[model samples]
Target: MRNLLVLGLALLLAGPASATEAEAWQALREGRAVLLLRHATAPGTGDPANFQLGDCRTQRNLNQAGREQAQRWGQLLRRQGIEHPRLLSSRWCRAQDTASAMGLGAVEPAPVLDSFFVQPRQGAERTRQLIEQINAQPRGVPLVLVSHQVNITALTGIFPASGEGLVLALPLSQPARVLGRIAPP
Candidate 1:
């Protein structure tokens, strides 16, 4: 009986951390936060030397499992009450495909969301530009930005896995605060 009670107490203690994902989803659904999602698995690091922004064949596109993972993210968002988020994506094929696979509404290409992997010097400038853009936007609806891991890390200071999302409270006057992260379900 004592062991049972201890186990129950432990489970209770672990509840809040586990509940953060749900809470993050709720925050996003309410338009009180923004979601920055790293593009789903592309099965490779950075694009190939021959990569071209407009051609999926030339870029490291999403593999089969990655595609399914992206779809699952979409379903999770829908289940969490974010039916129509303002979706934005990097111009790269992988980012664009991930955003489209989310089944969210039309995705607008945001150049600032593009990967800075090749041009590391652009990271700081691009991060600043992205923050400015988000600050200028009216936060009346949920916003999801599908971008590369480098871009996401630059903005949030969290190196996210592919298909992972970081929920952030956007403060116009300062850097965004990361509320929580939601991994692919």
Candidate 2:
């Protein structure tokens, strides 16, 4: 299985940028994988002090470039025939918008994926909870989590930029490992 994953990663990276989404989709379709997506290109750091959860105007929302990237990522998924994925996201507006722009399906607001960037340091407990969530999914179907940079970095050990994503193959009785990263087309 590991060998297969390495081959897949090689193929993905070898292909043109426009092929990233399809390669990622194929990987997800073939394994019990979890997709950890960094929020789209919101050109800023943390949210403001007065940021509200639901109100986009009050939060650090996605910019025009971010929105286009998000939509394009979704389009790529659709092009690759990925459907009915279980979508999850951080409570932050940027993460939520990134997931929503996929237009794939209902996205659950998962606090486990919330950014630890605001905290003095990273939160291990929250990251563990998220890992548990991914591990708890039933067999079959793919899981996608749209989250902040700190949260994704804590989980995957790789700091992905906005709109970038990691595909991790999770075995039923073993730990999960990163397969490859998917950059926007």
The TM-score between candidate 2 and the true structure equals 0.81
Between which residue pairs do clashes occur in model 2?
none
Error of 2 at 60 (Å): 0.8
Q: What is candidate 1's TM-score against the reference?
A: 0.92
lDDT score for residue 54 of model 1: 84
Error of 1 at 71 (Å): 0.4
Task: Estimate the TM-score of every prediction.
Answer: 0.92, 0.81
- Residue-wise C-alpha lDDT for candidate 2, range 9-75, written one tens digit per residue: 9888878754654565666875467778899998878988887777888888899999999888788
Model 2 scores worst on lDDT over the 10 consecutive residues at: 171-180
Best by lDDT: 1
Residue pairs with clashing backbones, model 1: none
Please state every model's RMSD to the true fold in angstroms.
1.8, 6.8
Off by over 4 Å in 1: 1-4, 172-175
